[model samples]
Target: MDEHPEPGHDPAVGALDPRAELSEFLRTRRARLKPEDVGLRSFGRYRRVPGLRREELAQLAGVSAAYYTRLEQGNGRHVSAEVLDAIARALRLSDAEHAHLTHLAKPKQHKKKPAVRTQQVSGPLRTLLDTMDGVPASIVGRRSDILAWNRMAAAVFGNWAELPAQEQNWVRLVFLRPEYRDLFADWERKANDVVCQLRLDAGSHPHDPQLSALVGELSVKSEDFRRLWATRDVTVKCNGVQRLHHPLVGELDLRVESFHLADDHEQMLLTSHAEPGSPSAEALRLLASWGTDATTAGAGTPPTRTA
Candidate 1:
């Protein structure tokens, strides 16, 4: 709403950072590969294009020249399953990269409302989360839906069961409510991680309507979300340390271990306590006491954590 603005931003602030990042990444990745890598030949001619010429790649992938060009140009929105597989093969992509490529090329499904997806952890995973008693562990969905957790996790994350269902989303908590800033000791770092993981999820599960809706909501509600979403940095989030300021524990320094679910589009998250005999550990001990037997009866809570 102001006439004066920062560099690369208009009065409206139209262009986003994510798009630039995505385009650059694609260009850089493609540029590194040669014809022999994908089972093609250069014919000993000095190539006009830096990478596999756009047309050559399209031919190898069994796609139209126009379509591949559109995709590389970042103009195309939706791509079919067949084309995705073909491109994956042509690019000589690894398993992880192939999965990521599919996520990017596909379009996110449209949903009326961002209802949470049900992806419960197995008995083993639940037991594992319980076994690591000192850790603050939680299973989440593509849109940061807090699914299930251990006692410390429950305490560290403000007792999810006591909160409203719609308020369970991490993005919702971070942007919609001011409480999150106080919850994390290093709020800015946590905020970046949240958005980056969300961006990766967006790339991986393009058909997830729930995720799309949450992004739409976040982009509308928070300018920070809008700016970060524009970055387009896709990465598989696994391990990280978090400094948490919890309601009961005060503060905690914890280490995180994230395991991907087998073909379920979910993840098993375990945030283990880093220090023993420290204030954080004592707080975790208190949190465990809070979830002692007969305190609150509960069953499994399942949500996909595609990190």
Candidate 2:
């Protein structure tokens, strides 16, 4: 064998284990949720497990105990579609969560390695991506490539665009590279965001070789990443606050939102505010105007220098 099976080092800043991922997701989803959350209840004052017991859930899903256990253990292969549907309903899975379940239940079928969904932008999605005048937005596929970006978005995350096509994963930069720590005002919050997003991807695409490899690489690299990855939290990425530590203009509190095009696949819109004539917003405007990519269609220009 060559000196190293995979030459380049991933530093393992943060990584996820699919088996553990599936187990945690199932356990937590089963816990924390009150019976009232799903219209189930127990009479006596005694309950051994939190949330619904494993057997109770199996009953609700119309599955056998051993089967559901295997599913939660991430060892169940070739699960039936009907059982999956039952589990989805019993778990009270959201649309995104449901899609993720199916991905796990079914083995991935692809000839060449799939490109993590960087392509396949829908018409309405393209239109929405184009119209965002202020926020810097970009659509990231399952592998987290910066596929398409709006003008302001490009500026805010300029460094990502400047990177070679292959090196644009946000998680890679955050944990493996020192620059990631400097870019966010609240490192914990931003780190949490990264971890949560990665968790979501892990659940949705368990069989993606590249995705698995990327995550495995990160897990071995960074202790901080590993710790956060262990939290096992996932998000739908609908809306959130992002704190930015700009190398040029201090910090800007941004409102970030995500809208999905094809179910779980979506684009993120990152916008900063300047009160009509406020200094920060002014800075934002100046940032976009300074070195904006005017020719790029949907993404017009950055509110600031693309860093």
Candidate 3:
């Protein structure tokens, strides 16, 4: 990755321009829906646009084309909730997408000053992570930064503790590091999930400079990141399954769960574990015995015990 910012990048802090973001998001959403998909007839033989036209979408949403056009142009300062709901229905948006639209249209008032403090893991949370013996767990802060991680997490995901503070981000690790690209069995799917989660975060906190900077950096460095970020997908990370190819362990399918911290919603406790009595479970057992050294163990190293 280049240490210098890409040419034309603002030297100040990074932030998604709300108006531009809203316009692009609405355009993409509208482009994904066809007239037939929404039970509308195609009146013309050769449609100029990819999906439904602006007027057609406005008609479907039960609003004037002028009003819808204004909204789509990112002038949603006076847009009503009922109208937004109608538009969301017309676009066939998911719950997450609907929320993202709402956030874009009706952004919260931010403080005059920008946030600068770094997130920290509390001592109690650190203790909790340490006590979660066999589970691979980590506390992730904004931009998927690995704030704190346990021994199992180090063994499974590599030692984040050894990385520089700014380099301990999931996006950075997954896109910038070749090892992580090989680590995930389904690299494309995992990349989409990571970008979607970041999109959701971007919508919720559009004024976050650090997040904007992270996005800018990734966009400059990784073509895959640039492609995925443009999709405008949004999703809340609750639970999922990830297949990993650990260097020490051959292959492991782990259930991934994320729980947002009650007091600090910006932070989440992420854990990955395998099923009981499975080969993956046995693999975890072996890694636990090897401890943090499992990260340094070469992929070709002979297994001390059979799974």
Best by TM-score: 3
> Candidate 3, residues 114-143: lDDT per residue as tens digits?
675679999999999999998999998878
Candidate 2 stretches greater than 4 Å from native: 1-21, 31-52, 60-62, 75-82, 108-135, 148-151, 161-164, 259-279, 292-307
The most accurate candidate by lDDT is 3
Candidate 2 lDDT, tens digit per residue, 142-199? Answer: 6565667666766565545567776777788777777568878777777777777766
lDDT of 2: 0.65
lDDT of each: 0.64, 0.65, 0.85
For model 3, the stretches where C-alpha displacement exceeds 4 angstroms are 1-13, 43-45, 300-307
TM-score of each: 0.61, 0.67, 0.92
TM-score of 1: 0.61
lDDT string for model 1 (89-147, tens) is 88766665566666555544566524446666678877877877656777776567777
lDDT of 3 at 292: 58
Off by over 4 Å in 1: 1-69, 75-102, 106-117, 263-265, 290-307
